[model samples]
Target: MSAGFSMHIFFTRFPLESQFGGAEVQTLSLMEGLKERGHHVAFLGSCPVLLEKCFALSVPYFDLNIGPPPVTKWHAISFLWRQFLMRKKLINAINEQPVTRNEQRVIFMLSLSEKLLLTTWAAQNKIPVFWIEHDSIGRWLRWNPWLPKLRRLSRLATTVAVSDMSKRMYLDLGWNPENTVVIPNGIDLRKFYKRQKILRSTTFHIGCVARLSPEKGVDILIKAVKNIPNIHLTIVGTGRDENCIRKLLEQSTLETHSNDEGQVYHLSPTTSVTILPSVPDIVSFYHSLDLFILPSRDHDPCPLAPIEAMACGIPTIMTDACGTAQYVENGKEAIVVPAGNTEVLHEAIKQTTLRTYEAASVQNTFSFERMIDRYELLFAHSAKL
Candidate 1:
């Protein structure tokens, strides 16, 4: 088993299948990188509209949905049950010996179902299974009934966590820290290149590219924008909270209020706030804005949007809870603020509007090429074993 050896990796979701936050981007980029290296790659899963839009022109991968229809959400009582059934299908695939690798090193993306199947098959066949954990264990262990199974899989497979925080949490939860690898998500520098000249905009635009979910703290940014004068906010991404955000903004504007402390909590209907639909061309959106902000309220493994914005030579303001905050230096590359603090977010946005900075200085450390090289090394090593 070596670098040139033919290996097949199974993805639970095609990188182009869903509009995922950071995990999907990283996984899809890795798949593309591996394909570029001439590895025989196959994707196995379904995708939603967001992913379809993002990767519409991407290379085609294998999709299992061509067979009989998969289990529906209406039939499954819990998320865990659906996951269990999906893995059962994959387990059958392995038992049937559909795909084969001479020096088998199986990699499983974020699918817990695939993780279990690979672990079980690996234990029986002496094949190595690598489990890529994209989210925090703390977040999943709370409601998921599969923690015990995850622990078992962790012991059998090489667990790859995207951030140090996520890896530490897994270790705290009694996972074998030795088998875990912390591979921080990297930005795709080629795609996210900064524009030579900033796009001319009528207003000082503060933009964010994130799922409109509560954890992302889009509302916090909205509240912060209320304090900044003459600043317009553009939020990208859609989620379950989209309706809630629309309602909140609509109601806030209708409330007649002056600039008192309560005014921050209450929105005057007269305020100018624009909510735009998600766009396929995020690069253009990042370039069109004067500044980028990440106002996440909860801990995230690592976010690629802030790093990508910085790569495009756009300065960013990210909250402390963002795992990628480690890459930013205050007053140099980006402005770091505490999560859920509207005042800090407001001041950060205000300061960015008044600053003149060079994006090249901050974009050196994050690049897609560098990330691909790291994965190539990891995959090579895995195949050798």
Candidate 2:
């Protein structure tokens, strides 16, 4: 399905993050594809990292500068006042450069607050609200209850989930089945293609790209790595658990060494682990890995890193609990294992041989073009309503 008419799409995020994740990557991809297709697209965001990204891509964006989340009752009132001011500013910003009457307007948001806050204004202007939810249920966001009911009362025109597993989770959380739909996170295969490994390291190499948060299970992966006798593990990305991961490394019998590739810690003569906060060239990281793994213990709604690795024809291992599990077949695209199982993870890591994967099939299945097409259809339908 495709939108026959051009749209003026406004993408949004609330409680924005400093470190980029799959959602940010997917948003940029959608914006790029839509811009290429001649749609007028803009980002309404506060995050510095994302705003700079929009600037680099030459995509227009409006910054509704944000403040910290409230930690107390009085702070909550202050936060609400700040949001009120932001909403007023947001309204004025949109009014200044309004879309042409012919192009349909769509507010594509990533949070429930966007819908609840903008409902009356959106309805008055004939702009349909589309919630593209990325987080799974039972995350830190669900700490409260009364606000969820309010969000339901202000139910959006459409809700887009990143995977079937994600869709199901929201369905249980009282999302309208008629309005909810699934769109798997997509990748640009040209950027993440397979390459021949020219240089080789003697040790078996395993790599994982994830935020070092509790839900991501980086600690579990570390425990599994400790058991493996002969291995080299590279953990990429940064989050709250950096110091904890370092401590885990130090507490173990691993020997630390300073290197050009950042810090390298050796568990033994046959085992070494390198932890890099960020990689300058990500495609090179994928190409360098012998095996890629996403050991998410609780929930992950269709992450793009493993898909990028699969696009590079690397054998993958991911837990069954995450939304990314639905995309790959067992022993084919990736090795699907039970979540948080150290022994199983250790056993899976033991099989160091790469599998025969058809990267072309992965490219065809999860291309950003197809993802945009699905979104176009969804937006087109909302416009018709």
Candidate 3:
């Protein structure tokens, strides 16, 4: 079906400007694609960062004035009160839109609370809703006791999982398999593609682009590459664990310095490590790397980093915990290893350094065009129902 429908996307977490993760990228790409197809896209959320991005994209949006969810009990009560007020605003915003008989109006939500609130409203109003699931099950929605009761209302909406593994996970969490569909995350080929291969450097450069969190296994990567000769690791992105990572690297350097008793040190450290904040020019970052690794300790559902790196003609190493591992073959497009196993990760990096292979292309499976097409079809189908 062609895409000339009106889609209202509800995502109230980190804004596209402040936190550009896989989910944020997907949302922006999807909205842009739908707009290109002559669809009207609107974002309904309270993230100032996202509002700025929406303004840049020229997409109409409504600000719910909500921030991150609360932590304390008193704050939780205040948050729920704000949500109640936001729901009224949401309903008013939806009612204000001019109703067109020819165009389909649908709600697409990324956050669990927003999905529940909006989907319940949509069900009562006979509007279609699409819930995009980006992670594995056991998230806030599934764990909430109200989920079972909400399932009836959720029947009016469709659940979209970003990967097949995620789809199974949702089903295991009691989502109707028939209502859940697998649609892997996609990347814009224009942003990530193979450049002319550069001359090999004397030192092998390994890179990782992920948040410095425990689940991301950046610490494990640090341990794996410690004291290794002629290898450099560059980590891009920061999180709560940044301090811990810095301490770990400091300890490694201390150990290395103490171990150098009679040996002469070279100008460059045998194992070099650099931690950087997120950059806008990620394509250039991938190009500078000889190899990319995503050593996630959790089940990373359809991570975009590895695919982006592969699209840039860089060989990547991923853990089995990544859902994208199902799409890539070991020793081919990527090297798959056990998550959080520093020894295995270390060995994989060493082995990959000695091996030479052609750059793999993910255009067929993970291209943005393919992803948008699937979403268009789903949106069209949902509108019909």
Candidate 4:
């Protein structure tokens, strides 16, 4: 359970500095877990929120001088060309802390470009790098000339998929099957458990926590609940579709309010919905929900929200495309519905209201400890420690 010797871990794209979501939370959990076990953990990216967090935790952070990825596909060629200099800046940053003979250096990347760009640097230094890909790389890069070389370089490090679905996706894209692994994301069960004396609110409360993108299928959930009487819908997230969702809400309901906490709608005193762009903490929110739904319409690599909710013992309804669907048994830990089927989803919402679905101690398979153990074993073997 211990590294015996300190392993220096530099992780990239610390969320909130650039963006935030499930992968960011999982990365943070991994850093905290490794730090607790006496490993030397440091952040390798920066943003305002990340800086504040790093300072508060006394965790050192270094910015990767690699500029942001292309905002448009036409710019991708230029971005790839600039990675040559970016790689040099990163290597210089990594070398600032001299490595001892006994010290093992690890780079944990959660982004495709970071993995591809750092491969050569890691191979030259003989460091073990891991890229736990949480999203699929867009197909626009498939035809790019730089990708062939990058893919070859990518072979130098391990590619960790967050779920079997992601593993299959990677294999389909010609990733080396031998070097890839599937590690399901997990949460702290102790922190996400249900409250004592479970009680439902006067109105049926259904919840979802995900980025408000079209692929997330939040609109489907809203549509599903639109006709349901005396129910409350709560969504917690922020993304490109925030304005679109707000407009949809304004058209779908009677009363609406927006603030720093996000938006609120009152269909009536007994029927309402609330949307919070973000929350500092979500344990209480999960505990308060009678049902949790993940209505993703696309290949969701691995979502931590429903896992946290399932850990808290909330009834869960998820679409088939969600990566975590493989972990939970249908009709047991959670109910699985086809993605984008508003009729079926709405019916599920109506039928599952006030009912409780147990996770059947899914923590045994997806606990943070279990996830940390798998990661440690991978590193131990890779580091030859």
Candidate number achieving the greatest lDDT relative to the actual structure: 4
Q: How many clashing pairs per prediction, in order?
A: 6, 0, 0, 0
Question: Global lDDT of each model?
Answer: 0.66, 0.77, 0.73, 0.77
What does candidate 2's lDDT look like per residue over 56-128, in tens digits?
Answer: 9999988875454343345445655676876676677667767897888877876544555566688777788
What is candidate 3's local distance difference test score?
0.73
Task: Please give the lDDT score for candidate 2.
Answer: 0.77
Higher-ranked by TM-score: 2 or 3 = 2
Span of 10 residues, lowest total lDDT, candidate 3: 258-267
Residues 54-157 of candidate 3: C-alpha lDDT, one tens digit per residue: 88888787776544443334544565567676567667867777656666677777665556456777787777788887744444445555467557655667
Off by over 4 Å in 4: 14-17, 46-49, 136-146, 257-263, 266-270
Ranking by TM-score: 2, 4, 3, 1
TM-score of 3: 0.87
Q: Which parts of model 2 have CA positions greater than 4 angstroms off?
A: 66-83, 150-154, 197-200, 359-361
The order of the candidates by lDDT, greatest first, is 4, 2, 3, 1
- lDDT per residue (tens digit) for residues 1-385 in model 4: 3645678888776232255677667777888888888788888764544545766778888755477654346556677578787667777878896666766899887654566667777878788888778774455445555566656765787888988988887787777988899888878887887766565557788889998888899988888888777888889988889899878887877777676665678766566788887767798888778889999998898898888888877889999898899888888789999998999998888778455667864666678888877888888788762
TM-score of 1: 0.82
lDDT (C-alpha) at residue 278 in model 1: 62
